[model samples]
Target: MEIKDWITLVVPIIATFLTALIGFGVTLNKIKREFKYTIKSYLYQDIKKLYRDLYVCLEKVILDPMLAFEDRYIDELLNFKPDIYLFSSKNLIYCYRDFGTYLFNINEAFKHYKIEIDYEDYDYDDNGNVVGVNFGEDEVQEYQFKVSTYKEENCPSSKELKEKVENILDNLKKELNMV
Candidate 1:
């Protein structure tokens, strides 16, 4: 074959391969972005649900006189409850934890309660027979809320807090026919 003909054939082949490669690269990048967004949104949803339930429970504590839960006790219990998780190619693990105000009086009035939920893990290095972990250590996020008492400074703003308290009282009064 003539050298010129060979060179022409090779150029088209190289061009075709490079084009294919470029297309593949773009596709891969798009896939990666979508994957990350999916994971972030999923994690957010799980955490949101967990927090919503937690808030419902916390509200009961703040408002209910015949309360199933106590703000102070919750504060004390905040040591560990509610957590999040993580999943990645390098790390196959899940984590979950959170903290918030537990007390609410009037002056710096509210004592915050921090809650953390840990996705238990196994401690292989530990000498003890303890195998798996149950929501081990909590990584605190927004811990200041639990430490502060002011409505605006903390959470469950003054209006929200007052509403909860009144709701609880109203329910109690109605139950007992107090008014």
Candidate 2:
């Protein structure tokens, strides 16, 4: 083939190759951005839910000291501990650590005042076998289980802890751009 003919063929081939490469690059970039956005959205949703639950539990404890002894409130804190450790950002992690420490101190201070109530029950099968035990209204027993009064000065006020939690949550909201 003549030089001019060869040039014509080679230039079109190069142009087509360049067009395909640019198209592929643009598509990859778009996918990357979409993936990032999806991950951020998921993390934001999870963090928001967990934060709200923890805050509510803390608020209950602050509003009513007796509620602090409830098993459910303690369970909420325990459940949140691992998730916060795993998924929280650096600042949130620090806040979680501080709040956890404060909660531990409060619990320790209240240890003497802990109370336990026991209920007696019997569950029998047709053959009179004790298959299970039910703690119901049939029999009830109450005891001053581990009851001891602590000096008021020994325990930290729940209000202070609540304030710290609120501050942390506010900072978290800002960090997550939810505010």
Candidate 3:
């Protein structure tokens, strides 16, 4: 009815609306922060798993005495490429490139070695008496093989790549405030 009465009603309504709006904004912000943290955690875990897979493949290819070709290693490495490219940042992409280069160089070095097999002839007496064995030079044959006498000095060490991945994980943890 009067101005003072109208003012009183309008002030309480405005204050109530403002309080509700502020409360909703705070709740929304909290939800956003939680969502962001969850997403980051998932991403960090995925990246770590990818790095582990790559590391295992490289180690097997570089250290295994029986590994003939790098086909399996290359396949394992390439499996993570799309994920790295799509979900990772620039720094991670660079690290992946460095890892890929190391693998390529190791594979190339392994290609240079060849496998040679030698046959031996044994002499026997008429009474089945054992004599000596002869390994003539002519009995040896060399064939191109995928195996490598890979010395540790020939390729990048796993420690170096591991440190790089750990550094990336550390950075991610810092960014997410998980550390």
Candidate 4:
């Protein structure tokens, strides 16, 4: 072929190749951004829920230390520990560890110092007649002393748990660029 003819054929081929390459790159970048957004949304939701639950648990325990030994609290800790390790940043993981350790100590302290009281309820008939007395089925009251040497010695303050949870959430926000 003549030089002009060859040049004409090569130029179009090169232009088409460059166009396709640029288009592919743009599409790939968009996919990457979308994937990152989806992951971030999931992480944000899950971690927020986890932190909220943890905060509520801490508040309850601060009010009544015996609540630390509830089955729901135990299950939440067991289930979320692995998730925290897997999905949290290094700083977040460390904060969670501090928080979890404090709660564990509180649980242990309650195991030793919690007080339970069994009480009875009376079912009265009309005309002020005594009918029946029902014994403890779900009539048990549980509490912990406000001034306990064991709790003062063993468990960290509830204020500490609040701070740790705040730290973890702050780290998560920084990671996701929501700060």
* RMSD in Å for all candidates: 20.0, 8.1, 10.2, 9.1
* 2 or 3, greater by lDDT: 2
Candidate 1's C-alpha lDDT? 0.45
Residue-level lDDT of model 3, residues 1-179, one tens digit each, is: 99999999999999999999999999999999999999988987877777556556545644552332465765677787897688667776777676666666656655543221211245667997758655455433212211222443364555665665565555445434568
Per-residue lDDT of model 4, residues 22-129, tens digit only: 999999999999999999889888877776665565566556554455556766665777876886688877876876776676676566554322112556678867
lDDT of 2 by residue, 64-166 (tens): 6654444566667778888877877778778877876766666655654442222224567899887786554433322332232342444446777678778
Task: Identify the leading candidate in terms of lDDT.
Answer: 2
**TM-score versus the correct structure, for each prediction:** 0.42, 0.69, 0.56, 0.56
Q: Order of all candidates by lDDT, from best down to worst?
A: 2, 4, 3, 1
Q: What is the C-alpha lDDT of each candidate?
A: 0.45, 0.69, 0.61, 0.66
Model 2 residue 42 distance off true place after TM-score fit, in angstroms: 1.8
Supply the TM-score for candidate 3.
0.56
